[model samples]
Target: MKEEEILPKLLSCFKETVEINQLIQKEINGKDIFDSYYESDLYKERIYKIQDLDTSIGILIGRLYKTSINLNYYYFDCPSQVYLNHIEEREKIYFDENIEADEKDFLLNEIQYFNNPEVNRSLDFGNFDCYSYGKYIDYEERFKITIRRKLEYLSQRLEKYNLTVDIQEETNIIDDNGNMIGYGTEAIVRTKIDKEIEPIETKSKNQLTANQIILLLQEIGFFIHPKIEDASKVKQAELISLITGLHQKNIKTNIQKLDKSVSENGANYQRDIDKINKILDDLV
Candidate 1:
């Protein structure tokens, strides 16, 4: 995938991780839930799903590291640091007198692999002893920390890009005759006037197929159960109704609370709200 595509895919993976983590937390740590819930089938199933997502995240991070290196981007340093840290851990393991002789020998033989240019470029650390056989829980905790730091850095950078785009869109105004009229607040006012007078398109039930509607709902952050995708039309329709109610209620609550002035990224908020509304209108 291209460098630009990796970031959005990573963000989606992060979102899935968060949702799954929340479910696990609620099941295991919620006020009324017992600690034994961790051993239940439901918890095991969610943990399996999360493990799959974590693997995907690792592969994506590797890909992102490769892309960053190819583009000579500064973000490459983050993954580089991860690799360096891993190598440091391996060195410590190699020197530790308590470790098995075979393990130290294995590390000594493959230590050059860690320094290989191809290995460095790929950033695939999954085969290392720490990841594959050693203290896995400790390795996983470190990996989670790495993911959190990268997510925070990427989110801040993405927010800056969005702010820059919003500012440019607000200031750069072109008239119907294809001439630049003005800039700044005056341009924003003209743009708002243009939008206010624009014709509204009516949505029809036939405009989007059932599958398309399902995809749109997913795009808007609604978690439609996978079984619904293969269910009967009646069942799918029922699921959609339930999701629509939840989505609309959330919008209603949040929209009322949003301040008219200096709202947190109002452009993105309105855009998502519009998408949900359009899907609702089409379904109607």
Candidate 2:
């Protein structure tokens, strides 16, 4: 299959897995029902089906990674590593005192032996059967959690390509006027810029002081990731270098768009084109 097709296929598989998990949760809502049906053929069949889907997802992820590498594209950390991080976080929560002892034990057991049931059985003299463990656990809830974590890991892997499979509802940002400005972190960044920065008129870009430039960039949400708490403390040369690098990145992105418009659409953007040429001339 083509690279573009893999994302859609992966998303479909995830959707099906989520639907099945929800159905299982609905069917086995109470503890007694979950314990009784945990070992039943129907429940086991669905579990195996989910496992199969997970295998398919893993294969697709590998293919996507290979394709990204071949294309020389940047990607986030490996899905396996993301999943491991999730497990580590859960383990930390399990160690907290607020969690009950029985709950902690169940979580610990699941964390350690989830992928190796045979090891669990061997170590516990065949007395640590998964079905028996279900008596103290909500099997369907655990299954749902596992599936959601898997989705999150896979989504993080695909994020660089802008192909995230959103499993939860997103929060929307509302302005003081009660208008929806945007959603998530992007909206927060936009609102920050709008509220904190007033428009300033400079005769030329070169006339703007280093401190002014730094403040402008900060307001425009440039120093967020690395987080420069005080741009004034940075050396003048270093601040200029940062501004130069940011300018180059912006130029590269906008120039590509300008090129596409001029060449393909034959758009008459001569005035803006001349402004870019003037900027380049000034640099020279």
Candidate 3:
């Protein structure tokens, strides 16, 4: 659903969860904390209680709905209406955490990039193409003859299937040829319409940074595939070098020793996976 529709549902769920938390807190404390103490020792101890209550409310609020994560489109609905149509093979997943507020908004923006319905539909629309062709009968009339043969075949198919068929061919006064939607305006005309695609919003700088990290991770994954022996050695040496703050030459020296221990170390690429991850985390 659109944001206009989603806001109310989210608000309602938040309100309901808040109410439930209020009731639970009231039942446990027999009174509210704000009325008794915000300026005293009681307040310090009560801070923990307030935090507990807030966490409870957040969890309850989250449990009331489902979150759908899509690669190309994001969709969200309550459990009752979670099914959707026309999504590509990328599966929808969910995160159950009550993430921090800033992180949540940032993630929502990223999700909107893929799941925005207008954007998704526009992507599908943009790939539509149309073509038009024509044939002139100046030489041996092979083009015209092929067109007639196809038409005759189509007519026979219509008769065999007992279906109505419309066969219309016009003679061109300029070219003096008989054809269907063939040749130039002097003989025939054919037209096709292409579906236009709308442009998507440019990605945020933060998102671009994260994508870069993911690409690096993918490259590292290739270096440590399970099929290779001592694959774990290179990964381990990289991890050790990360903690030890070793120079590139030093890290390579360590990795070479590990490679010497294992037979399948052909051209293993060097990668700084930690730095890439740090960059991604900073953006998030």
Candidate 4:
């Protein structure tokens, strides 16, 4: 059953249990104070009613416990920590000296919603993402694809300007002892910016950043991923880093970690990774 349904039934059952218990106690007290005077037909009926109520209460209590366990499971399964962290980060944005009282009060109430499961559940409009708001928690696969496609789009753009792209990949054969023996014959795609394109046009009033250039290039008969475009600045940078081959540092300001690292350590090709890391880090 739904949590909303369970809660009200549990409350009604509890209230009835309290009322029935009071009646039973009152009858016992009257019988002790007035001897057999309390043994009327009405008194017998009340006693039977108490027994029936006790049985009903036992059943209700069992259902309550089961329903409670179900609710607890739902609560624990939710991405509460993710939402809490988001709220905490948002609230900390107001820690600066020039914060307004109204803004502070609004944030205070927003944070309280995370503490109340009923409020949070009430706001769950089918999309039960761990975070209460429209915050996304999983975009790793989307990021990877976005970066790869963007690089391909950039490569095509370079070709339009009479530039060539070279991409190469080689796999080293590892023997039983895990020592690199020989290189595979498979051809790897390579990328190289032409020296001729070093001074690309940048004087336009709406000149694109290096990353935006990559994104804009995809607009030529190619569509950019909406998620990537709609993503936060930090996410965009991380996606760019993944595609261009760079180590993505966690977003320190927002306290969100990009747990996946696309960097190659102790690899022969460090130049591209290093160059991309520098370019993206500057923007990040």
Candidate 5:
């Protein structure tokens, strides 16, 4: 229940996670006849069990932290899914003699573009074949790296509070063209830190929950139609609108519009949160 006590539990949970990851890694490597055998019914069952256990542990750890998750990014734009769906449709169109020559050429070019690795990294040249044992291992390895990086970041961040926590949430950073470039991860920390003194004007201000921010952005008005598909941009727009009261077609534009007053208020609010967290850390 206390702040100091939280770290030990987190460390213990992480130890379990590490063990599970190691076990999975070993299975993925396979030995003798077992090499590349993740396709076996037994292996599939074991993999699912490990995944379920990991989810359960993560949930338990979140409860201990008392912090809720905010969706910062979407790592799963799933371009592979899009490419596959389009392939099926394109095939049907290609077979249609009634289709125009120019339209058919356009479809062929689009498919070729999706197939090009230099054009899109997420393209699945294997079609759905990547769902098999050998390919799944590759997928698992990438996922493992992502999880480890997140844990490392959180452990370092919580070290200041003498607590360690691990929670995985994706925040997809996109470029001006709405292409995903990178992402961020976040976790929650709940401590029994005593409430700090409230400044007169800012004291009554409430932080908006993730859902509230979404609704607020929709109410502010959309340029064309709502772009809810890219959550990171939506979040950026929400902050920019709140601070500058101006709307932009894209995230970068909105961020660039932040003025001195908005910047100072954000800094002050963060300082307050940090002060409160440090106080809570000391108390535990």
Candidate 6:
């Protein structure tokens, strides 16, 4: 598309994304849940409880990445299937189906924490639910938000070219002017603004397909090793070995050091794919 058309649409999309960013920022400003009458042993108990839950979530395979999830976060870290099973056993319903708003808010709070732009402390909670809000900027949530904003911008911009362009492949509807309309209670109310527009077959350079991303991660040398039952169990020695290899090659990957915090959330979060991939790779 021409710059004249693309820029304005891009600006519009970015404008909308500001709302999302603000929401995220607001969420991060909230306090940690473990701030209650916290004690050391109690904290350890909570960690193990979550890890046991993670063990189960970690067993299931991920549809998108074909790996175990990190059920500790009880949000994105859990495996889909195992977590689904865990949820079924605990809540008797899926998260999206019957979860209470308060409970969901609580869970999403943790998700938001783990997904915080600054998630460095998340994996290293050290007997506490460690978290950071916006400084890390290296976590998956930031990556997703960044990519989505860009897509929205490009999609809006492309319409100026009189082209039917959408950044998201799953996008089903678009107005004639090429702006995006959100979902509704029933059939989404939308009107086409263009009389006729040609669709673009080209993919965006920055956007990575699910499979492409998986392949790229593999190329970065994040493969499964079955020698250890749990990644978390890796003592200083294993940590040194695994991290050394990755650091030498300049790549980042999580080492679970398996510990069963199965009573935790991700087991039933219904798609903690990342954790599942990490765990199941060895089991399989």
Give the alpha-carbon lDDT of every model.
0.43, 0.43, 0.33, 0.39, 0.40, 0.33
- Tell me the tens digit of each residue's lDDT in model 4 across 10-71: 34544565576687677677456666736777667766776665565445444433454445
Model 5, 1-284: lDDT tens digits are 55445435444544555576687678776476656566777677767766765565555444432321121111222223233444456556665754655543444344233222222323122334211111111223334344444345434544555544333232223344645343322232322131123111211135442223333443445433545334465576665556532223333332332333435434333444454455447776
Give the per-residue lDDT of model 1 (tens digit) for 100-180. 555434333332232121222222232331111111112233333443343343333334233110111112123444333
Please give, for residues 60-119, the per-residue lDDT of candidate 3 as tens digits: 333333332222222222221222232112222223233443433333333333222122
**Model 2 TM-score, 2 decimals:** 0.27
TM-score of each: 0.27, 0.27, 0.20, 0.22, 0.26, 0.19
- What is the Å distance of residue 203 in model 3 from its true position? 14
Q: After superposition, how far is residue 33 of candidate 2 from its true place, in Å?
A: 5.3
Q: What ranges in model 1 sit over 4 Å off?
A: 30-36, 69-73, 76-284
Instruction: Mark the regions of model 2 whose C-alpha exceeds 4 Å error after superposition.
Output: 31-34, 69-75, 78-284
User: Model 6, range 1-284, lDDT digits (tens) per residue?
Assistant: 33234323323333344444564446446657555524456545545654553343223212212222322222333334433444434334334555654443333332223222222222222444333222212224433443344334333433444432223331112233422231100011111353234222344544433323333344445444453323442242245445332111111112221222434323322233454465447676
- The alpha-carbon lDDT assigned to residue 7 of candidate 6 equals 26
Clashes of each: 0, 0, 3, 7, 2, 41
Question: Superposing every Cα of model 6 onto the true structure, what RMSD results?
Answer: 22.5
Q: After best superposition, candidate 3 residue 93: deviation in angstroms?
A: 28
TM-score of 6: 0.19
Q: Model 3 has how many clashing residue pairs?
A: 3
Error of 3 at 283 (Å): 23
**Each model's RMSD to truth, in Å?**
22.3, 23.3, 27.8, 24.7, 22.1, 22.5
Q: Model 5 Cα RMSD, Å? A: 22.1
